[model samples]
Target: MSIENTLSEIRDINLNYLMLAQQMIREDKPSAIFRLGISKDIANLIDSLSNSQLTKLANAQMMLARFRFDDCSILNMLTSYNKDSALTNAHAVMLMANQPVEAIA
Candidate 1:
């Protein structure tokens, strides 16, 4: 494939990931933070951004998506078991966030 095509594919994938992240932020702040490996401050900042700002940020020619998996030990820990506890926890948090709060009678 041409360089341009490869770049275009990367751009599309990045855009898709950005969109999914934004949706997760809107749906569940804590889960988004955990999954995105971002601090609450950064998550809040992202949550507060306008759609245009998000679009501009996502559309940058080159964007860096940082995660906390740089350490081999951390990766090893998560992969030690058949199931990843971190992912399970994140999914739980998201589900809780989506649950409707009930008022006591």
Candidate 2:
């Protein structure tokens, strides 16, 4: 189900998922992240995603729980990339990701 649905029913669960992921990542017990999958029961509810995005959400949830990266800039970065990849062409790359030969400036 959508996060909205889960949030509507189990407000604390998803919030706790977000928070606990951040906390565990901070504590460095990275392996503990997978436990967040208990909520995976709702995976079928979210829609409009390809097989890959479902995987990314699943993976992101896992990483978010595992890394406990509540303060993670990486989440923003991942969000950006995910958003972009969904909207744009596959050849897009960040400045740093470009090869020396690919540089135009």
Best by lDDT: 1
On residues 30-93, what C-alpha lDDT tens digit does candidate 1 reach at each position?
8787667666777777778776776666665664364344555555555566466878556545
Backbone clashes for every candidate come to: 0, 7
- Computed on alpha carbons, the lDDT of every model, listed in order, comes to 0.64, 0.38
Candidate 2 structure lDDT: 0.38
lDDT digits (tens) for residues 30-92 of candidate 2: 333233332222222322345554444444332222332344443455456465564333332
Model 2 Cα shift for residue 95 (angstroms): 41
RMSD of 1: 10.1
